[model samples]
Target: MNEVVHTSPTIGSNVEEIVFVIVVVDSTDRERISVTREELYKMLSHEDLKKAGLLVFANKQDVKECMSVAEISQYLKLTSLKDHQWHIQACCALTGEGLCQGLEWMMSRLKSR
Candidate 1:
């Protein structure tokens, strides 16, 4: 619903279930947004949500037009996430690279719980 690229309707029957929320961000204007890193942390740090957890797919990684992980992390101040299992991964959906790893990490996190 929120400018998402491909949204599969998962609100239904017998799916394995999604335990984590995957929050996407604009690799460019990280500063202009209010509901960015802070909101993500709020979601992840919610008392009830602590176990459910979450991940972030920093897509558009292959583009010369996109921000690097170091840059994005600096802007978001994600050093705290390193110790936590906040899976922030570099991905290029255009080339289908790193997509499986991102999804695999999500599945692993869910299964591990």
Candidate 2:
């Protein structure tokens, strides 16, 4: 029963039956991160998605000015998501770093549920 749902921040309200959500954000962009966080909050706040798993992929970790995972998590206030399961991962998609770990985490969480 592994199910994944991919959607843009704006259209999340249109989807249903979401077991996992992969939220990718640029580590250096505060504005984008803020918007993404709000969107994610709204989506997961819905009653239907209360148990959905969230994987916040902090992209562009290779960039020198990128923010740390702790900073991003604080900025996004991920701790406030008390009703959902979520994890943050620092990743560089171009070099394929940290992607597997995030996916594996999501898989393990889903399996546990």
Candidate 3:
């Protein structure tokens, strides 16, 4: 799993702020799930990103053995993030499925903030 950090320009704001963090996970790789979860925790706990929303792309959903979105969310302990805003999207990079929804969620989060 590759941890990706993305900063989007705030809506109608000139300054670019990291209103959210995106983590791209290889949903098919179950062995690395725990490590990925820990890495995510460390990243999100950083003082610089304490208030950042989380957007997780559960990649390789096209694969038959890939973990389901629910499974990924549970394994990542997303429910425990009561103070943070988050969304887990099941996506296939090959076909670009679920990408827009994730971005839209991020944008909504930014707007809400």
Candidate 4:
């Protein structure tokens, strides 16, 4: 899926904070696959996400045909994942359900650490 990156979003009262580029990818089924994180980790696990300042948001959780969060995580062998503390959640973006909380959690997770 194509994504448009949002830069310097005023997430809450936080002013001019650095926001990571958000890469959008499909929550897959039909076959097993690796997340971009895994791809990067295979290429360089020691170079953790902090080294690259990367964060992932695996979205599209409410599609009728979309895979469950566990399925996506397992198919990607997310246990092999590292660096970034990201995972999928059941969401209906069209309805604004769970998006804000997810975004807030992301902002806090990346910022507080």
* Candidate 3 lDDT, 1-113, residue by residue in tens: 69899898767757767568899999999999999999999998999888889999999999998899999999999999976789999899999999999999998877776
lDDT tens digits by residue: candidate 4, 1-113:
59998788666784554434344446653442454545645543453335333333456676777767676566656576465555454555568666676677667766776
Measured against the true structure, the TM-scores of the candidates, in listed sequence, are 0.62, 0.79, 0.83, 0.51
Tens digits of per-residue lDDT, candidate 2, 78-101, equal 898887789999999999899999
Per-model C-alpha RMSD: 12.4, 11.7, 12.2, 12.4
Local lDDT at 98 for model 4: 63
State candidate 2's TM-score.
0.79
lDDT of 1 by residue, 1-113 (tens): 57759678867677564456776666655565355867877876776566564566777776677777677666666676643566677877779777788889887877786
Tell me how many clashing residue pairs each candidate has. Answer: 0, 0, 0, 0
Candidate 1's TM-score reads 0.62
Which segments of model 1 are wrong by more than 4 Å? 1-18, 33-35, 81-84, 111-113
Model 4 regions lying over 4 Å from their true place? 1-21, 28-58
Give me the runs in candidate 3 sitting further than 4 Å from their true place: 1-18
Sort order, TM-score high to low? 3, 2, 1, 4
lDDT agreement with native, every candidate: 0.69, 0.87, 0.92, 0.55
